[model samples]
Target: MAKNLTTLALASLLTLPLIGCMTTNNVQPIATKPFVIDSETYQSAGKSQRIKFIVLHYTVSDNERSIQLLTKGKVSAHYLIMDNDDDKIYNLVPEGERAWHAGDGGFAGRTILNDTSIGIEIVNKGIQPQYKDALKDSELDYHPYKHFVEFDEVQIKKVAQLVQDIAMRYDISPKNIIGHSDLAPSRKIDPGAKFPWQRLHEEYGIAAWYDEADKQFFMKETQLATPTIPEVKQAFRDYGYQINSTAEWDKASRDVIYAFQLHFRPLKPTGQMDIETYAILKALNKKYAGRDDFY
Candidate 1:
């Protein structure tokens, strides 16, 4: 009887191990959490318009510094092409969503800039004071105090290539590509005079250009009559400038002139809209006469 009981006990122990194995196999695993997207992520808004323009700006901070500030801080961008030796491109903001670059501005009769455009902030220090941000001229210290940063040759190439990519991807027009300061002149002066707007226009076919073909015709038109305040205001509005027009001519005109200088002739930027500016605007207005088709 004892032997029989021992045999039954051993059999039960063997069956218990199999039961435990079966229980382990039957237990199901929990599902992982779904991914949450950042606000910067480009969620499809059902439709996308052809990219009209590429607005340019300067990051103002160094690559490492920019990364830190943008990552931790609330500030962000659609893309950041560095001015470093390597000149790598960093995309902080997605193309589908708007980036917080253009604060208050108008373009081609459009307002509230963030939604309609893609901003590219190249690493640069714009309009630095003569004594400020100067590097110590020493190789030992990587970052000097107040080192004025400018876009290097490599940086420009990187910008061109990336701009080309964006232009191609979104069908961005060469005429529409512009700078931040172009749309919002009263408040900002960035991607400043030292940065190359002409090269982008002349070489890369970015932004409006004063084509040689229209030079004589434009000159004749400007010389025909002194443009009146209302006419000037109308021209500004027709070209997508944001001005009350009720404001004094000096203030309103300066806004338009500043916008022009930032995009075309950044070197002098006196905001006077001299004969050179008058000619440029006439050319642009002629070129973009039918932008509603795209917008």
Candidate 2:
């Protein structure tokens, strides 16, 4: 009886360890309580809207790659407009939070645009694959107008809607609705020549655009004798481009001119000074900055 009883006790002890293991495995984890802060009674009256500029860009890639790059990669944007049949606009970063889209760029008198600007990345395969690596400084090597891809019609509509919405909410000036290339003329050229700026200006009345009359007046004046290179440089600077006082048509000068043409002309961005280009520059300056001495 004693031996049987002892054997029964050992069996029970062995089963007890198994039961404990099962119980431990089935145990529920305790959830942490959410933290809370209350500040309903205080507000500051001396605050202003953080957003001052809206910089636009093209992803230079397909929709999937663009999405992955903007979200997972080091670069990011406040908004991403997909180039797909679906009309989905992804807001990757919050409007209040700064995104890492504008890298080493400045616009107007402002530097480090990522601080005061909201970036919008539109998905498009920018330059064609064959010409992707071609240099842009010389038209003989690569011309953005010839190589760039057109934005989807749906994408343009979406861009207009989004820009208008943000502009209204933040009271952003039309002049502040600029391209990435406009911000960083030297190293960047995006939202390229193929972007329908004229259409946007005509149809939606969105973004900064010059009056045709103003352009024509400047054009006629420039036909007789265009402004000197130094004067043109000052005009570009006055109109908020980061240009230097280099009297000659140097590479930096050409880069800025290319950026301006990319925004205003789109068709003929030769990066060389011509009557039409000068006229457009003068018109833009006169309209936006109210500076009228083009000659």
Model 2, poorest ten-residue lDDT window?
286-295
Which candidate wins on TM-score?
2
Question: Which 10-residue window of candidate 1 scores lowest in summed lDDT?
Answer: 139-148
> For residues 1-295, what per-residue lDDT tens digits would candidate 2 score against the true structure?
9999999999988777565467765776565775556677787777767788899999988888998998898999999999777768899999989899988867777888898889999988888887776775444622758889888899999999999899889877788889999988888889999998889878988888898899999999988886888998888888888887878988887989999999999998878888888888888888887422211
Candidate 1 achieves a global lDDT of: 0.69
lDDT of 2 at 288: 82
Clashes of 2: 0
**Candidate with maximal lDDT:** 2
